[model samples]
Target: MSSPTSSRAVPPSSPPSTQAQPAGLWPGLGLSAVAALIALGINHAVPTASALLVAIVMGVILTNVRPLPASTAPGLAVAGKRLLRIGIVLLGLQLSLGDILGLGWGMIGVVIAVVVGGLLVTEFVGRLLGVRPAQRSLIGAGFSICGAAAVAGVEGVIEDKHEEDVVTALALVVLFGTLMIPLVPLASTALGMDPRDSGLWAGLSIHEVAQVVAAAGIIGPSALKVGVIVKLARVLMLAPVMVWFGLQLRRRGGQVEGKRPPLVPLFVAGFLAAALLRTTGWLPASVLDPIKMLQTFLLAAAMFALGTGVTASRLKNVGGRPVVLAAVTTLAVAGIAWSGVMFIG
Candidate 1:
């Protein structure tokens, strides 16, 4: 099978050494993520919504100060992605038929319809807003399903190298979305939706699961749990959607279009298989817990890979198109997510 590629490209030799000793994975990044947790207090940060905010801000700042190149083994990147997907599946442990049963059949239809509908609307908006192809791909994927990672996964197959445009775009979406985590709950309460529907809207609409859970927890734990289940239903679509898009790129001559490409990711397949296992009930909780534990490790490793690759030189002014594209597309997502929540909730 053909492999996926990254947006970041590497040089033949080394570019001028920005630092005397450039650690492959920034030496203190773990410390910094930990420090962020400590400073914010575990009550609020860590993997919660606020943690993503801290991570992205720190990541961008680190990018400007010491842009680590994410030149890791192609194998590691592939393994990292699959592990993340499995972790997502383990998230299923938190759900069962009970939550959906409580919400009733109508909520289920609403959730399903909105996710399916939103994907089409977001894609059209991205294309119309003239988001760069890669940025368009990222924004569309990020909004439609999981953010950051989803964009990275699909882009892994579609693009040949990690151009600044892609990273810059991902950073902005993550940055802006992270910053917006607080507002979602406010909007939810203001709309006067009940906790059941409120949580569904939160999970279905929020870009990241961490964001959904955080916002819902602030509103209430029941909301948090229900929202997570809603989010997973959306996550399930990543593989089929990516496969469809990947076929288009391969048809377009894809990375062979010319460039020193990175390896294509095979995790999408793993993700699909895991989902199938979940559907078939082949993996019991006995095994799922270990998988979840493994995912936690992978999430940290992938973040490390993503962090080392970040650099401010590319994120610099970067002209205006990418930023403009992200802003417009994000606003576009907000419109869709909000309207869906209102009508469906």
Candidate 2:
């Protein structure tokens, strides 16, 4: 969590009141918006495809095929981090405490177990396989919670010095999440699972909300409804999990006080507030509908920004360790979630 020191020297006579220039945000935001539009078009053309997935794919292709300008780095960083947090905040509007509790204690317990156990198992497997600790933790969190967003949340706290880890974890999330879209429905049907159970399984185990929705949607509307609620229940665990990681990082020392993510991030608090607002019936249907639309667009943009940070070179340099870790973690989560669903039934 250390703040990066600037190599540039300031003159002793320079005014203390002077501030550094702010990074530009337009380039990144513009690209992200373009990606989102492309994703939207893809989603429209192929109903089963997820906009978020398309956005990320477009980002990766653009970044690798034609490198972005150096000037766009600052804005892309903003799009990746700031926009991501905002999207996560907006994600809260989709959930309510009542909706979660209505799933009953059994389903709630399953979610808790999957999140907690998946995180621990993934981290352990990553470490055992010799992946870097920070990267391992990011992978674990990504699988256990909300995919790239969860990994970004953990990185904000631990402030991993390497950007490669973030990209690697996100790449894996996109890959496995995409794969789950078809596999979950096929497996659920073969197993003769009730649509509700299939939906819950998809929601609890899939890496991203969009992926969860895609998987559940193929199962049916009932499964889609069940999936979203269960997914949000897992999302609710993010704040506490992040706080725990932050505290652990601080205890390890070398953490800069102001640079570290807060124990309860403002965005997480905002998410809770949004959920409460939904529960209160104060937000009219007119307002709620637009906000939901905004949430998808924002997340799609953030995901595109995240994808732009990745490169084929970086992935090659890391070798196959990350892929192996991703595979292990994916299996672990899927197994745990499937077992939980059957046990609950």
Which candidate leads the pack in TM-score? 2
Candidate 2 positional error at 163, Å? 0.9
Query: How high is each candidate's TM-score?
Result: 0.72, 0.89
- Tens digits of per-residue lDDT, candidate 2, 211-318, equal 898899999999999898999999888877887887787777636324655566678778778888888888888998888778778877877877876779878888
- Candidate 2, residue 206: the lDDT equals 94
Top model by lDDT, which number? 2
Error of 2 at 88 (Å): 0.9
Worst 10 residues of 2 by lDDT: 9-18
